[model samples]
Target: MGRIVRVISKDASVVCSAIDGKDIVSRIEEIHKTSAVVTAALGRLAMGTSLMGFGLKGKDDSITVKMDGDGPTGALICVSDSMGNVKAYVQNPVVELPLNDKGKLDVRGAVGSNGTLSVVKDMGLKEPYCGQVPIVSGEIAEDITNYLAVSEQVPSVCALGVLVNPDLTVNCAGGFLIQLLPFAPESAIDQIEKNINGMESVTKLICGGMTTEAIAMKALEGLEPNVLDDFEVNYRCNCSRERVENALISLGRAELEDLSKDGGTDVECHFCDKKYHFTPEEILGLIKE
Candidate 1:
């Protein structure tokens, strides 16, 4: 299980959230069989979504983040519940590219820049809240920061990272989100900026045995931070046979009848690749309901 720690400055002018998501990313990589670059890209998105979802006020609230880019990866999608459980998938898990000039995995090249980053928040309301912004860097972190600052009108700094081993296993994965609340003083903002500027990369800090709480403290070093909450999170797929059946029912009687002609059908979840089979009789039964 991964852990998340949320903190607020003593003056309540800023909030910082951090996650150590190695286990979550490892489970996702195992399920998706993603290439190095894709793992890094999706992992970063999942962690960022988890951090964002932690801010939801309702127990049942959830957030979905989607990146539709022109790169080979196609689209990367991550969903997180208020409790921090996350599930994610990429349109092309096998897509890979050569290392970039930085001699690192070319995440930006794989994610592409020509696209949009969209977020939807479901708070059990009549209509969910939606926001969208053009992809800024396709580097995941920068794009998330851009979305927060532009669409959400929150000045935030986001940093996400994933380190994949030579054998394609996750070594460490995590991220941090620091947001300046409205009416925040200039001194608080400057202190937060200085703290972030002097800190190491998230992955490096995790690799050095720093916990999420420590990361939050580092980001708010001079701000007298206080821990608000700490909790565990995981890459959890909520898909079930019942949910699949409900989805199939939503296709309408005509569609159900057509599907029943085939004797049976199989549905696979995009997030977890779990397959559910339904017999023709079952399909017809759903039609009667």
Candidate 2:
């Protein structure tokens, strides 16, 4: 099963929240079935969203993250609930990138350096809280941290990573988020910063067989964190033929009539790249009804 762990790391003057969602990212990567770089970016974003979403307070609270870029990837979107459930997709997932200097998938090249990352939180309210920040690194983790600091006014350190195999498969994927609560002590901040800078690559740690709990613990060594919860997540989509039909019907009677006269229509899902066909008769019926 896909695994995800959330922990609250605290020292005398600071409290840090860290989430490691390795397996869940990998599972989502599998569904995209795209190029290595695309999968890496998607996986990283998914992991980041899951981590952030799981950090919410209300039992039924949820968060949605959207990245609409000027790059070939077009847009990257993901949603996560407090229960650690996450779903995400890219508008164009077939784009590939030349290997970077490190001989690894170049996620920034695929995601583009220009765009915006927006987060919207739903707390079962009439209007959800929204925050947006300009994309900083396109690498995902840094952008998330930037969102927290600039948009939400929260000081945070977030790191997300995904290693893609030469065969275009995922080797490892995970991330950690460290948030500095308000009025945290200076020494606590210094130690946590040192720990973060000295820590090994998150992907390497996870691929090396480190559990999520263990990774969080190592990052929070001196700090004592009260374990909150652990959860398993996977790639899931809420799309269906019914939803597609509703969208098409929303085109109005005129468009439906035109489609009926022409030979119906064909629609493809941007998320899953699946197509649905509609017959002319069906279009006519839709227009009539």
Candidate 3:
């Protein structure tokens, strides 16, 4: 299990949320069997999406973050519920590329800058809210930062990192999101900027034995930070055989009739690779219903 913490400045000038998602990312890698570069790219995206989902106010509210880039990784999608349970997958999980000039995993090369980053929020409303922004950088962190600033009108700083071991396992993965509340004082803004500039990458801090609360405090240093709440998060998919059956039932009588003639079929979930098998009798029953 991973941990997530929410912190706020004493003066209420800033709010920051941080997460240590190493375990979550590890589970994702295990399920997706992603290559090194794809692991880093998808890991960062999942962490960022979890942080955003943690801020939802309603119990049933959910968010989906999608990166439709022109890079080799193709489109990456992550869905998170209000409680910070996230499930993510990449279109091309095995795509690999040479490290960039920085001698780091080529996340940018794997997730190209030529596409759009879109977010959809389901808040139990008639119509879900959607936000879209041009991918500022192929790096997932900058793209999220840009989405918040442009689409949400909130000045924010998002930092995400994932360190993959030589054997393609996750070493550490985490991130922090700091947003300036409305009418934030100039002094607090400057201090937050200075603290971020001086701090190391989030993965380094986690690898160095820093917890989510400690990372949150580090981001809000010099501002009298206080932890509001903390909780455990995991890479959980709510998919089940029943849900898959219902989805197949929605395909209408014509589609069900055709499927019933096929003897049997296996349906694989996108988020989790769990397969649900439906026999001809099951399909015929659905068609009759």
Candidate 4:
């Protein structure tokens, strides 16, 4: 499990959500067996969406982050509940790429610069709120900042990163997001800018054994920051046999019969490669509308 900490500046003009998601990211890598580059790419995206999830106000609220880039890794989708529980699907989890010019994992190469990053939030409303922004750098953090600025009209500072081991295991993964409320003063903005420019990297901080609380405090170095709340979340999937059967039933009785004539049904979950098999009679039993 990983922890998320919610912090508010002493003046309440700014708020931040900090996460230490190494454990959850490690679970994702194990489940997907992602290549080193894919591991870093998906790890950063998952951490970003997990922070978004922790920001939801409603208990049933959820958020989905989607990216379709012009790279070998294709599309990446991640879903998270209000509590920060998250699951993700990678279209190409085995993509291999050389290090970038700076000797860092080429996340931008795996996720090309051409595409869009879309965020949809279901706040238990009639329709979810949707926002989209063109991918600025395909480096997760920059794209998140662009989306918040252009689509939501919120001036935000975001830092997301993942450290991957040579064997493709995740060494550490985490992110922090801070937003300036409308009432934020000029001095506050200046202070934040200075702190952000002076702070250590989020991945470096996490790898050095900093907790989510410490990271949030570090981000709010100049401002009077207070820890408002904290909670833990993990990587988990909600797929089940009943859901698989319902999916088969949605295909129509004629199609079910046609498929049953050949063999049974094999349903596999994309988020967590859990497989479910049904016999011919079982597929026939799913004839209900």
lDDT of 2 by residue, 20-120 (tens): 55556666656667787888888888888888887788988989999887778889999888866788888887886688898877888888889899999
- In model 4, the worst 10-residue window by lDDT is 258-267
Native-vs-model 2 lDDT? 0.78
Instruction: Flag clash pairs in model 3.
Output: none
lDDT scores in order:
0.94, 0.78, 0.94, 0.90
**Residue 263 in candidate 1, Cα distance off native in Å:** 2.5
Q: 166-248 in candidate 3: lDDT tens per residue?
A: 99999999999999988899999999989999999888899999999999999999999999989999998999988988898
Listed in order, each prediction's TM-score against the native is 0.98, 0.86, 0.98, 0.96
Error of 3 at 20 (Å): 0.4
Cα error, candidate 4, residue 30 (Å): 0.7
Worst 10 residues of 1 by lDDT: 280-289
For residues 1-289, what per-residue lDDT tens digits would candidate 1 score against the true structure? 8999999999999999999999999988999999999999999999999999999999999999999988999999999999889999899999869999999999999999989999999999999999999999999999999999999999999999999999999999999999999988999988987898899999899999999999998899999999999999999889999999999989999999999999899999999999999999988888755
